[model samples]
Target: MPAVSIDINMFWQIINFFILVFIFNKYFKAPLMKLMDTRKEKIAAEFSEAQKNNEDAALKNKEAQKILKDAKDEATKIVQLAEKKADERKEIIISEATVQRDKMLKSAELEIQKMKHAAKKELEVEMNQLAVTLAEKIIKENLNSDLEAALADKFIDEVGGVK
Candidate 1:
């Protein structure tokens, strides 16, 4: 053949292009897609785990705050109760002291009254005895006169009226 015909113009070039595309899909494209899917799944699993950990930490913080509030409330109640008890004890002590003081004052007053009465009785008895002795001395010294008889009667009446 001195010169070829042009009926198969560009046919060999198109066939070579299709074979290259098929070989690249079978050997490189499929494996690349599988690797990309696996990496995406791993990243998604890590993100989910991080989210769960954050939720757990938030719940723990809330519980800790609640416990702290409860402890503070209990402490306040204990302090108030102690103050009330102290007030009650103080009142009881004051009342008991007042009662004891009153009792002691009454006892002292009664004792003083008894002492005063006994002193008055002793003074009256001594005065009467001295008056009788003086009268006897006067009578013995002046027995021979009428004036002496009248004096003796007056002395006896004075001595008898003392008590």
Candidate 2:
């Protein structure tokens, strides 16, 4: 509004400012922005990889738990089977022992019966010999074969048919 003064230095200053802007845009701005974008992509990719690894770990942990549970079930079945086999074996052993005991008792009873029969036979023979001796003494003479046979038969009949 007063006297307008044009300075030549102002023109030079404007030209210098434009040259510095052009140099920075061509040499620094594009490369710095590209580097920032690459860094951001690398960080995003790392985050995705970390998330995938976490999911895989969780799945593996679940699989491990399932395997452990199956092993426990199998062990329980094995133990139950073993107990059943043991019970069967115990029953078989007891039955065998009982059969053996019964057989031994029967054998002992048979042996006792045989011994009793032998003892009774010996006593009868002794009694018959004593009777023969007494008859010979009472008659004051030895008996002939026919008379001795008759006498023994009569004595046996008198003694209630003892054999």
Candidate 3:
């Protein structure tokens, strides 16, 4: 066989490489790269928005718990105030009842005293009339002077002894 001859050139190799790079960039590389970058940006924005929404929800929950605790404390205070007022009213009612009972007892005692005074006056009048009638009968029957004096002294003694 004859000796082989080799002919290699760096300029042609460089030209072929540039042509291949241009063809690939125009056909497929630019659009695929743009789509991937846009997708990555949208995912990052969504994650950031989700984190902000979670923070807002946590703050709202804390506010709600504080409001609920305040309402419960207010309700308890109102109930305690109402109980105190009820107790005060009960005390007032009891005091009024006691005053009324005392007044009634006092009036009843006064009425009893008045009745006793009227009965005593009636008894005094009746006893005086009976003594006068007995003295008149003794005088009409003509008793001796000594006996009459004795009977009058006895009647006087008996009347003086009465309450």
Candidate 4:
């Protein structure tokens, strides 16, 4: 059987390896891991903030579009209202003009009727005078006032009565 040999150098090497692992864990490995974790958290926070900003921008754009559409609708309504008012005004003016024209026509007709009545009265007076003269000429004598009036009445009765 071969003899197994244990060396003191192997024990020292094991102790040295444990000391190196401890130093690395305390000084370099723990700080490096902590720095990596901080960097990851910062990157995550930045991404979240960017996403929130994007959502807010989208909301603002939608609100702006809605406001523009409402303005256009309001403008259309205003134009329609103005046009309706204009049409109403036009109709009112036309109706007023028609009323004025009708009043003028009525006034002219009344004036014409008054003139016709006055001319008829004048004609009647002339006819009565002519009848009195004709009666005097037929009798070959000047008539008194009472006789002239009677002759005039008789002449009027022989013709149709005045209107």
lDDT per residue (tens digit) for residues 78-99 in model 1: 9999999999999999999999
Tens digits of per-residue lDDT, candidate 2, 1-163, equal: 5486658997899899999999999999999999999999999999999999999999999999999999999999999999999999999999999999999999999999999999999998888778766764654445557778677657645653443
Candidate 3 Cα misplacement greater than 4 A, ranges:
1-25, 133-163
lDDT of 3 by residue, 1-163 (tens): 5486434665677788999899889887988898999999999999999999999999999999999999999999999999999999999999999999999999999999999999999998888878766765665466668777678767756765563
Model 1, residue 48: what's the lDDT? Answer: 93
The worst-scoring run of ten residues by lDDT in candidate 3 lies at: 1-10
**RMSD, every candidate, angstroms:** 7.4, 6.6, 7.5, 8.6
Q: Please say which candidate is ahead in lDDT: 3 or 4.
A: 3
In candidate 1 the C-alpha lDDT for residue 158 amounts to 78
Ranking by TM-score: 2, 3, 1, 4
Best TM-score among the predictions, by candidate number:
2
Candidates' C-alpha lDDT: 0.86, 0.86, 0.85, 0.84
Candidate 4 similarity to native, TM-score: 0.55
lDDT winner: 1
Output the better candidate (2/4) by lDDT: 2
Better of 2 and 3 by lDDT: 2
Give the Cα-based TM-score of candidate 2 against the true structure: 0.66
State every prediction's TM-score relative to the real structure: 0.61, 0.66, 0.64, 0.55
